[model samples]
Target: MRVRAESPGPSWADVGLAEPGHGWSGAVLAALLRRRGAAVLSHDTAAHLHGMPTPHAAAPSSLVHVTLPPGQRLRREGVAPHRRDLPAHHVGAVHGLRATTPERTWADLCTRGAPWTPEDLIAAGDHLLARPWSRRGRREPASTPEGLAAVVAALGGVPGIDAARRALAQVRVGSDSPLETRVRLDLIAAGLGEPILQFRLDAADPQCPEVDLYYADGAVALEYDGAHHLAREQQARDARRDRWLLARGVAPLRVTAEDHREACRRLVEVILGRRAAGHRIDPRPESTSQSGHDAPPAES
Candidate 1:
């Protein structure tokens, strides 16, 4: 039910008292209503409302995405009108405003006409499938990986069907961040063998230490270090874990947001060399760094 609002404005009190963060979404919803009473917010606008990754300029002042009822046509400045019949299940209300469900929003983004790149589309898909972590613990996912596949199947002839299919094929479960998705994609593009995701150090303990990407047979673990991983506390913990992993004959590698692509290339070479040599590769270069931390997070 979240809607975008511009600035402080009148506030979205009607939609449960708009907090400062709701201002942009409040304004977005209000504008959609003013343009076409029955228009349903959709595409990137819906993606933003659903708390999904979107482009830099997806705020209210940008083009507002709305899908009108079939055969209801009208054009106005600053509004993008989508002509389609949204089935009941594909449409839903959030924070008080009508927007496409997460599945449907992703479908719209994947369609041919949408501007999203394949990497971003896959990233969004990963976000949709990865289960949420709540105070009580991990919660049920908003949609399943199978459900997303079905969505792409149902939209076979849609505008971006081909791109959607490609993106869907790239989506993976347990991807916790866009950076992780990017690294996976980069590795795949480099023709490296697929790395097992979120591999645990102890299968018996659900809360056991895990690596971002792991090669089980080779005992090679790769981690994507974001800025928070550089904190002293996190570094200390990582140092202990790295030492433990080393003691157990596992090789640990770290890639940062700034240098993951190149690092992944080097990793592919290492993996290939290890596969040829028929043994685990030793951790190198990066291991010499301070406290075994990875790269810093990108500045906002």
Candidate 2:
């Protein structure tokens, strides 16, 4: 049934969770849930919003029980809104406004139990990884204001990213990172489309390059050109591969540490588009290699 916020006030429905930075949306929703009789758990009320579904709970619906303030009788719905101090970790923001950040939510999700399978967690990470940086205007990080918002935005979420981020921190990649995850949150906030990750090309071998990050159907392949590729033998092999693919019309975009951060979206677009529009660069096509009947080309 549709809940409303009314009565001496509007029906609880009118007080649903609001968009980030909405007008008293957070406060209103908080009150409405309390009215619903959702005995709010003291340690975590953002439970629903921050944590995962409690499949094992007897009453998954009532799993959330809020403890409302003494005089704020919730006449709207049966759910109750708990008014207790949130632990340090549970506090953060999402989509700009102050709410629970994804990282914190992940940690909280883990702490709660195995409500979500290991695959679920991995999928969630994959789901959120490609995200870009934050676009919301500055929210003071504590003291500094100029460029401080970026810092605050980075630190705004859960600590899980610290591990994920650190784990893949050293690995040189063109698009995302080692776990085959998506881009970091900060990249998403900066206004970017999630680039295709780990896509397969129709090459004879069809073996995807280990370092490929952003790939288009037939467009460019953005390879994070790390220090490893600088070795003489590796460089020679890469040059051959580049020439071979160029002959087949697949332009390879070598993104460096600097370029990946600065020109991510544009670089991805140009490569993808170029390949689509018949870029001169060639890529080795799968299942179309020369037939065995054709002898190797005579020595030039």
- Tens digits of per-residue lDDT, candidate 1, 39-151, equal 78888777766777654223322666789888898676666789888877788887667888898888888883435778888888878876666779767767766677766
Best by lDDT: 1
Off by over 4 Å in 2: 1-192, 206-211, 263-269, 272-300
What are the per-residue Cα lDDT tens digits for candidate 2 across 1-300?
333445334322444432221123444555444444422332133433433323322333433334444554443343434343344553454312234444444333433333443333433433333322245732221111112122224433544434333322221212233223223222233444334443334443443333344333445545556676799997987777676556655666666655535635666566546656765422344422211111111211
In terms of TM-score, which candidate is strongest?
1
Candidate 1 ranges with C-alpha deviation above 4 Å: 1-24, 55-61, 112-114, 134-136, 205-207, 261-263, 280-300
Report how far residue 215 has shifted in candidate 2, in Å.
3.4
Return the TM-score for each candidate structure. Answer: 0.77, 0.32
Error of 2 at 19 (Å): 42
Displacement of the residue 99 alpha carbon in candidate 1, Å: 0.6
